[model samples]
Target: MTRFSGFRVLKEALTGHNGWAPLWRNPAPKPAYDFVIIGGGGHGLATAYTLAKTFGQANVAVLEKGWIGGGNVGRNTTIIRSNYLLPGNQPFYELSMKLWENLEQDTNFNSMVSQRGIINLIHSDAQRDAYRRRGNAMMLSGAGARLLDVDQLRQMVPFLNYDNARFPIRGALMQSRAGTARHDGVAWGYARGADSRGVDIIQNCEVTGFRVEGGKVQGVETTRGFIGAGKVGVAVAGHSSQVMAKAGLRLPIESHALQAFVSEGLKPTIPGVITFGAGHFYVSQSDKGGLVFGGDIDGYNSYAQRGNLPVVEDVAEGGMALMPMIGRARLLRSWGGIVDMSMDGSPIIDRTPIDGLYFNGGWNYGGFKATPAAGHVFAHLLATDTPHETATAFRFDRFNRGYVIDEKGVGATPNLH
Candidate 1:
């Protein structure tokens, strides 16, 4: 079947020499900067903005291969929740939630962050126990989370099928403030705001290599030219490994493809994001009334955005089970985005072995929600040269120390947290 992709339209929108807006009207002049950030995704752009905002470092430039937000920011399902199942991640994600709460007002950008709520459907007794512990842990950490039974799930979404489904809803762990945002709004807002602050947002400038001198990262060799910087940050998410290896650093992250699909605009069948614990299936209704959903990771190491058919089938089947009414609904869009799955499932926001180089990769799929907080925390690390207390556990050394923050306690799905 042919696909109806919002992503395809986006790729076309960012084309024609002058990528993204304002890139053509007035371009930036090439010069050495105080800080040069690679990858203009939500994380990278936000990091640069935070750096300048907090430290008054306006001599910063954000380099992008495509236009800003052309990467995962354009492709994410936009689920923002702190319903983490582990201690290491719950607190940090809670911090992210607070940041998300104030981001729109602060940035003067309509990120479209809706905190309506998110529900994780528990299909089995084991899933119930796991969610119970997760909900309790979240509350203890001062984040709101509640466990709802099958009856409660039905009450919340009356359309949900409680019986005769592949994964029956036994219960759910619900966080009232967990929700979504307009993915592109995040990147554009940050880009426009950062540019206004005298930060050079060099689009279509891909970093092909890194320049290191005396064991310190000096700058980046990009497609445009060699951009100099006192400190270089590799904020590249999906291409984190590829970008770092150019600087002779190896991160314990593997790239994988994650895809999301949207059904033709419906009557907003889903109030907020809903995830089935038994499978990696989740769905949410966009403001446009499209039923946006995604399944689990493609389950292999690959940079390919095209996914295997099994996942697509599984997601569709799960959607039908959740709301049988959508069984015949038209599938409007299908697209994939690559993710940098760190070993621990948590982000590695720390100073790598290389000096003057900061790494903010390995976000898994939490890039959208964590953008504001990622910026705040990463700036804290960059400006003060101290790992923010909240993001301390997400250090890069945790993998070697065996201190993995495996939130689902699943060694395999490091991206779940």
Candidate 2:
């Protein structure tokens, strides 16, 4: 594999850029492997890379139905943050935040991780109190947060509708290390690193069924063939239920389509990520000067990868409510990704009743932000039969044991979170 560096760039530039090699290999699946990962998205690829690099498990294969980055890994708004108020979530996400801080150098690829910071705008006194509590929680978790008063917030983002009588802006909970990254770059970096470490990345090879015998997973039946495996891990995002159903195990998750939008390119207006406290809207300016933003998911069970118009309207209303100037920007395009909404709004990274089968899903709206930690912890679970230290609370039996990590405190309702 070719190492990318400033010297390499200068050399390639001098040589007409013809010395560059492919990022990853498109090799055919082998007859069997020590481990098989069933998703090529960020979480799965990161898991594979960690298994190979950290755990020394190089005899691995990642099977994807479509090409890498075609799933939620690419179809996202690219926001990354660790602003949470829950005990189980705060530490894990903070770990992800730290990983994002060094991801580019660690992977030997530029992921465009810009820690420009993020703010959750408060609209009222009650909301201000709530955000203060959240900020305290974030600080306790070592994520580092601050409370910005109205004047400070106004100076930071002067274009917001601060005097709106309906949802008046009061303050904000800001995290200086939270920001965005190139979604595609993350997937490619992980894939390239995993492939460089001898992990076979089998694209267009979908897992059709689990090859189980006597309550143990033996391998997988894929579109290509029955690829034998000593252990199998699944990280499919929204299609978790359907995929796990093939193994006779039901998951406590529902699939919902979450839409994200990008507006036409213009002069950089939004400095960093800003979220509405009164509504679900959040916006950030991309390097291309396009306003990238999104809101709540389509409030219904769905396996489709596209969302309906009601959500589009709701997101637009949220952006307009937060910054009235957003109304002037025309929506350039929109896309959706199937989100696996777990019962408690927290993720699950645990082994199943079926032996040799491990599952990682139910990220809800926090998938992209949690990619690195989710992968590292999940790889820790797969490499060693124990949960990662920071991810001890994300277990499948949590709900039944009354230990649900509900960040929103919304009980077991998936959509409410």
Candidate 3:
């Protein structure tokens, strides 16, 4: 592959733009590979890239049922932050934020990562106190946080409904380095990087069943053919349970559809991402001038990629409450992506009971932001057969051991999380 550079781009532009080539090669899957990863989303592709580049494991294959970035990787609001509170999650997510800071340089692709900052609005005295504690936790974790007063918030975002009759915006918890990134660009960059490292990314190859024998997995039965593998890792997002069921493993996870919406193009209004603490709504202005936002999940188990209208109404209500001016902006489009809501509102990345089979799922709507670190740690576990330092708490046995990392304090409620 030719290295992409500004000079090359200028040369191609002057030469009638005919010097460009495909970012990645289209290669067929071999009969066997050293490692086989199911799913072609951001995490899976990142895992493949890390496995090859960091661990020196190039004989890998990533099997995607659909095209790359067709899943949650592309179907998110494109927010990235690590303002977590729990030790189990804070360090892991902080690592992801660090990786995100250097993602474009590492992948040699412009992911459009914008550290424009984010704010979680506080609506009441109690909420302000909670946010203060959360901000302290974030700062302690080295993820940078600040508790902004009402006057400070006014100076930052004067357009918010500060004087609402109810749920009035009092203040906010600010993460100056938290921001957003281009979702599709991230997936494409990782896929290209992995492909360049000789990892076969096979699209339209769905895994039908796992080839297991005597408590060990040998390979997988797929739509194309039976592909043998020395090790197998599962990273299917919302379909985690269904995919793992084929391997006879049940997970403490629920599949729910999370809806996201975009507004028609407008002038740059939102300076950065903002979340309504009184509600589940979060919004950010995209590079194209459209307002990208989303709210709570559909509140039910579903494998569908589309969402219902009630969520649309609920999200609209929250957005209107946060910034009434958005009501006048015409709604352009909306879509849904299935999320693997873990029982304890956290993710799980560990080896299954079956030897040679690993699992990485239950991201609970945080999948996109956690892509790079998820891939790096999962690759570390897969390559070394041990948990990574930052990810030791994301083990599969945590739920059984009552070590749940309930960041939202929602007890065993996937929908609430």
Candidate 4:
């Protein structure tokens, strides 16, 4: 792999910029590998990178059904934060935030990590108390937080409708370190890093079935042919249930479509990521001058990457309720990504019933923010055969064991989560 530097850029510039090579190799799958990751998205590529770079795994392969960066890794609204009140989620996400801080240097690829901060608006006294508790939890986990009153919030984001007729803004929970990253850049960087470490990234190769014998996973059957592996890790996001079903496993997950939108280019107005307390609306300004925003997932089970009209209207209503000024901005485009909503609204990363077969899914709305740590912990688990300390609570049997990490206290309802 070529080491990228300012000198390299200058040299390439002098030579008409023709000496640059591909970021990663598109390799064909080998007959066997020591480890096989079943998805090529951010989490899968990050897992492969960590396995090779940190765990010293030499023989590894990442098999993707389509081209890389063509999934949720690129479809998300790009917000990254660790402002959780739950023990199972806060520390893990903080680890990811730390990783995001160093990702560009570590991978030698620019991921455009912008820590412009995020504010969760508070609408009433009860909401203020809840945000205070959540802020305290964030502080305890070494993540920064601040409680800002209505005056302070108004100074920071004066465009918001503070004196709305229905839900007036009272305060906010601010996290100075929480922000967003370039989604596709994240996927490409991890893929390049993993490929440089001799990890085979085989695209256009779909896993058709698991090659299990006598309750132990031997490998997987793919469209390219049978590729053997000592252990198999499944991280295929929203398609978790369908992929696992090929191995006779039923996961406690449902697939739902989460829609995101971008508005026409405008002058920089939004200072940072901001979310409404009374609704699911969140908005931020992209580097390209577009207003990037999104809200709740479509309330229906869907394998398709498109949402219905009801969710579109609901999201627009939420935005209008928060910032009436946005009513004038024209929407540029909108799209959806299938999310794997777990029963308890948290993620699951654990060993399955089949020996040597690991599972990582049930991310709900937290997948993008959790990518780096998810990769690190999942790699640690696959490398050492033990769960990482921060990820110990994300177990497969937690549901049946009655130890659900109901982060939102929404019970087992997938849509509500």
lDDT of 1 by residue, 82-142 (tens): 8776777788889989988887776667788898799888778987787788889999878
Give the per-residue lDDT digits (tens) of candidate 4, residues 270-305: 998999847788999999999998899998899899
Residue 266 shift from truth in candidate 3, angstroms: 0.8
Error of 1 at 111 (Å): 1.4
Score each candidate by Cα lDDT.
0.81, 0.93, 0.93, 0.93
**TM-score (C-alpha, index-matched) for candidate 4:** 0.99
lDDT tens string, model 3, 1-417?
A: 677778989999899999888888878889999999999999999999999999999999999998988999989999999998899999999999999999999998999999999999988888888888888888888998989989998888889998878888888899999999999999999999999999999999999999999888999999999999999999998999999999988999999999999999999989999998567799999999999999999999998889999989988998988899998999899999999999989999999999999999999989999999999999999999999999999998998799999989989889999
Worst 10-residue lDDT window, candidate 4:
272-281
Better of 1 and 2 by lDDT: 2
Where does candidate 3 clash, by residue pair? none
C-alpha-based local distance difference test score of model 4: 0.93
**Per-candidate TM-score against the hidden true structure:** 0.91, 0.99, 0.99, 0.99
Question: How many clashes does each candidate structure show, in the order listed?
Answer: 0, 0, 0, 0
Candidate 1 — which pairs collide?
Answer: none
Residue-by-residue lDDT tens digits, candidate 2, 270-363: 8899988467788999999999999999989887888999999999988887788877899999988999999999999999999999999999
Candidate 3 lands at a TM-score of 0.99
